[model samples]
Target: MVSLRLRLGKAGRRWLLLFHRWAGIVAGLFFALWIGSGLVMLYVPFPTLTETERLARLTPIAWDQVAVAPDDALRAGGAVGLPAAFNLEMRGGEAVYRIAGRDGNRATVSARTGARLGPLTPEGALRLATEGLPDGRVEPVERDQWTVTARYDPLRPFLKVALGDPAGTELYVSQVTGEIALDTTQFERAWNWVGAVTHWIYLTPLRARPELWRTILLWLSGFAALGALSGLVVGIWRLRLRRRYAGGSVTPYRGIARWHHLFGLAGGIGLSTFIVSGWISMNPYRWFSSNAAPAEIRAAYAGAPPPLGLDAATLRGFAEPGTRGLRFVAIGGSWWIVTDGLAGTQGRRAADGLPLTVDAITSAAARAVPGGALRAVEPLAGFDTYWYPHGADPRPLPVLRLRFDDPAAIWLHVDPRDGAILQRLDLSGRINRWLFDGAHRLDLPGLTGSRRLHDAAQWILNLLAAGIAVTGLVAGWRRLRRTLSA
Candidate 1:
């Protein structure tokens, strides 16, 4: 029995060494690229149009020309019940109602003539793209490297317009919706090739097919996790603290192998966790559910379609000089108007045109989660465990957190200003937050509270990871040469 146990142990050690060595050879380069590119992404995130930026450029809604009432415009747009999304904004110097129905239909109705508008022509797209800037050129494109992701699917066949500005900015206007879908500057385009593009493997051809891209990421990250785990185990087994090596060193290796041993011992656990978390991000078994509020749940919360009972004069009174547009929202069985402008999004009572009171906002949040007893309502003035800002996407602060007593133990974060649902977290979602964001982004509550501390910790860990990869590459190269020579 003793002999058999010894044999099994020896065989296991041999297999572990072989697995770690060969896995390193296969995935070492990619690990290095991921770590390096992740650092680059820390500072220069992928270019995106933020809500504030989008609203800043939009001309204030032409309320004088808006002869059609909000209710009349909905009828003209052929909306049955409360539409999925009802946005009134200026498109190419015309105030239009963009109504998205729950039945997967969309319509753009002119506010002036109450006429349904069709898709934009190339000339119209160019005009929309260069609304505020000097137009340089316009070219129609189906897909490109920057606009290859599936999120831009609804706005396909974009018209790329170059603005002859100092920033070398290019805007992509949706031919279907005539909205400025995306904008990229020279600096953002140049850095993103090595940052987000390489980090996410977001090359146009691969990313165009989202499922294939996800599959590749799943398999590759899975293997990388395997490799990292094996290395971590091997590292711990070989590390000697009390009883040192023959040469009074903790590791039984020389030169590059010694560096690899030391770095692996230091950073292997973190590297393994990061890789595992990245694998989890692909959602291997579909264990995590989407956090979006369901259609029925949202409809229940809305209570009824927002009434456009207010007139043009009343609506015009709500606007300031830079007010971009106004949206009709249903909150707690009452209609409210949310104004988007230079001052940011603010809610007003549709009937009285008064600012939304705190009591009203809190009352509306109670109706959001039906059939669940309201356990607690916590107001978050800053980042917390579940509510935190991501890179380039700053989550609105001063949010109202509603906890429910449902089987899912659901939590909802509502915008205090507009009573909009910002995020929904259930049992599975909370688990995934730690598995993905906590492990991968180091976004723990303690670390996230202080930007300086988070940045410092990440930099130190990333440097150690980079060292491990560099030494692994050297060792792998040596092994390859020896195999060839042998």
Candidate 2:
């Protein structure tokens, strides 16, 4: 009886051990890739260039000094290697033109002086994306209601251009005098396509065709998750096998395998969380609402007073107490004040003094809520809590500027006008919103630290995933060869 029991136990242990080893070897590589890609995406900057950088590329020509026509400028500067669809924006002092091409090379030129500003050089852009704005960051200059002036290099000639949502607007500013020209047309349409690409992976028709890439990623991620789980099971099985067959003798390779199993187990959980959140974020119709009601409710809870149609100037005054370093204001039916708060701080607030049903008519001391409040409801639904600006720009919009508070905490939104509670959304909630919005943006302890950690993890995982795939193929090949030989 005892001998029979021992034999059965030994067989079970061998089976479990084989399962664990195969599972680990199979899933290790993919698990690493998903995590690595996620980390790379965390810090990658959006495609939009800073105002200063954009303007700097164009050698400033005197407003009175008009040298060439659009065609002449292109001819003088040499053939523009861009798509035919790119348009031109020329005024008294400045002339700017952009062209898109097949190779993802976009060129921006200063047409006034016929100077080759630069090809929004992909390499340079990528560098800027990796290494973000400098440390002693000044407040972003506000342009229009939805536009903010981002300075690339403060010491050099600053570029004061306006952007609305994530789209580029036609900003007419004096090239020589650096004065605001005519706010004729906002370049919302221009950036619409660009923003769409950045916001959703489905920007290009090719990308959207059968939603191939996304679908592939989904399946890949799913497989990766399965592989990881299987790996854990296999690893556990292997331990039992070792105990039964080897009589507690452990090989060095087995130890190494064991370590891999442990790390994979933990990393697997993190990767799974990210994947699930990311998938949920991609499906907005089923998850989020676009209209302003949910936003309003969230704002009200945050203590923001109702909106009142106040002119930009009045709104500025009402907001001055809470917002220092006021820059510019945009007054339409609703007023949006662009203020330069402390360095590295940026935010937005909306208010309506009248009742919910009444149209906001006055810019009086009505309560207002910051934009961040609307972002905090995402994570509870099992999504990551990073904020992603959905409509246009690929970058996460900063609707409220708060210093590095607890990343996990959601600060109270006060009405800039009345200091009332506007709304409250936690960091997790914001992360969830971002997950739906299609990006992972976590403001970690420090830029350097975060980037280093993310980059290192990515590098490790990608290599491992690639290695695993290769090894698995080799192993299968060897097994087939042996079987044939036998």
Best candidate according to lDDT: 1
Per-residue lDDT over 1-486 for candidate 2, one digit per residue giving the tens place of the 0 to 100 score: 999999998887676666645554555454434444443344443334443333333332233333334344434444333222233433223544433332333344564566666422223322222223232111223233222222212112223333332332333332222322222223433343333333344333434344465575566555545554555455444444335545463322344344454444444444444445555544433344332224343333333222334332343343323232222112223323333322222334435323221112112112223333222211122112232222123332222222123343543332232222223445544555545332233323332234466456545544544444444445545555787799
**Candidate 1, residue 457: lDDT:** 79
Against the hidden true structure, what lDDT does model 1 obtain?
A: 0.85
RMSD of each: 2.0, 15.3
lDDT of 2 at 297: 31
lDDT of 1 at 175: 74
For model 1, name the residue pairs that clash: none
Candidate 1 lDDT tens digits, 63-86: 877777788888999998887777
Q: In candidate 1, which residue ranges exceed 4 Å CA deviation?
A: 132-135, 358-364
Clashes of 1: 0
Worst 10 residues of 1 by lDDT: 305-314
